[model samples]
Target: MANLKELRGRINSVKSTRKITQAMKMVAAAKLRRAQSQAEAARPYAERMARMLASLGQAVAGNPDAPKLLVGTGSDQVHLLVVVTADRGLAGPFNTNVGRHARNHIRKLEAAGKTVKILTVGRKGATYLKREFASRMAGEITFQGKKRVGFEDANAIAERLTGMLEAGEFDVCTLIYNRFRSVIAQIPSDQQLIPAELPEAAAETASGEAQAWYEYEPDEATILAQLLPKNLAIQIYRAILESAAGEHGARMNAMDNATRNAGDMINKLTLTYNRTRQANITRELIEIISGAEAL
Candidate 1:
């Protein structure tokens, strides 16, 4: 039962909101295309690198002299969770989904009497997790105001993780992020980084194949020593690309929904404004008729 003036104000406010949402939707859509392409392009190489590592490391997996990145620190006492999220918001539950997944993972680890540590990649995730897990934070990295996420960013993260591993900070390291699935679906995923989770299929294929003894120009151990670090960076880069693409997809989907909702609200408000204005005009006409009749 708002007055015409109030209804007009409400309608104007909704119209302004609608314009902003529409603009955001368009911007997100434009960004999603580039992000999606980059993410898709990075996947095959990343997968191949992982498979190669799995096949190559099959021989030395049980060796005590193997690289720690491939063999881990011989314990599962401390766990490092690399939680990745978008630096910005307005992306529906995109950030929330990963945050919740990480939180649940931490709780499960704690329940099993395991020590948990966190390395957050985005401001949103750091802010979200610090509410309940302030002390467990090992580090936080944010890339706000950046035009795009690049391989260098991922390499920097990998370097930090490597440094932490060398410092004996954590036994096992896992990366959690949103994987780009489609425009409307970004799946929360977790991948073990340290101790490089090798694919059994690749290992079995390599071991079961009856081929000539192919010797490495530089031995398998030498190749693994060189490839392991690069593989680490590549894996992290893939995660970042997937996360970037997923963030854009989520934001685009969210903004599209918001724009549609704003349009609906504007329509409803316009109808209400028209009804209120008509009621006011009829009331004024009735008042005039009443006065004329009295006269």
Candidate 2:
């Protein structure tokens, strides 16, 4: 049993912690609103671009001159996993979940006798993944204090990937991230990046009817040459936006939970302190009364 003084000190500490957690929760809530809006806004544009790419892709499926970005290197022996995660912690499992998924993926790739390479974006993930997948790490993109994420960032990453692809560093690439579903739910997910894709639903489009009416201006090949790279950048930008939103959501939820738990602790400690102090005072009063009666 702790003495009255110790219990009082503990109560004070818990109250202070509760205040800090409350402040963090507020900040996270504000950030989450803005991030959520940005992510929601990007979804449609990204989906439309993906649909257009899919429609165009059908035209050049077998053509020898299709963009390499669309067709890949015709090999799956080497794979690159571009894992996206928060650059900071305190976001309950957001970074860890992605890292876990990537870890499993890397293991599966290696198991299949395929060479696997890792490219991590964000400081949090690099540290988390480096423990086990350190040998497979090809590079890391760290933006510790970057105020905002923008399309230019995605474009830069895409360009770096294109350079590596052109240099035959990897045959295929995949992106892993968290998709923001709600404040309490950020779904860890992955998307194919190297040989980009439309939504799975797009794959089942009206095949014969759609192809007969479509016409290209310069040519399907000519349009794809300009579009495929842009599409890649778009996809990456979408992933970044999604990840940014998810991180904030996770943080908000985490801080909220922390604040509540701290409040509960404060209540419990305060009760203990009051009871212990009362017990101490009551014992002192009894001792004084007994001495006076004896005298």
Q: Please tell me which predicted candidate would have the highest lDDT against the true structure.
A: 1
TM-score of each: 0.95, 0.94
Candidate 1 lDDT over residue span 1-295, tens digit each = 9787887888889888878988988988898899989888888888788767766777789889899999999999999999999999999999999999999999999999999999999999999999999999998999898988888988899889888999999999999999888889999999999989887754545767642344786788789878988898998888888888899889988988988998899899888888878888999999999999999
RMSD of each: 2.0, 2.1
- Error of model 1, residue 91, in angstroms: 0.5
lDDT of 2 by residue, 158-252 (tens): 99998899999999999998877878898888888877654553354544334344689998777888888888888888888888888988988
- Could you tell me the TM-score of candidate 1? 0.95
Candidate 1 error regions (>4 Å)? 202-213
Worst 10 residues of 2 by lDDT: 204-213
Best by TM-score: 1
- The segments of candidate 2 whose C-alpha lies over 4 angstroms from its true place after superposition are 198-212
Relative to the true structure, how large is the alpha-carbon lDDT of every model?
Answer: 0.89, 0.85
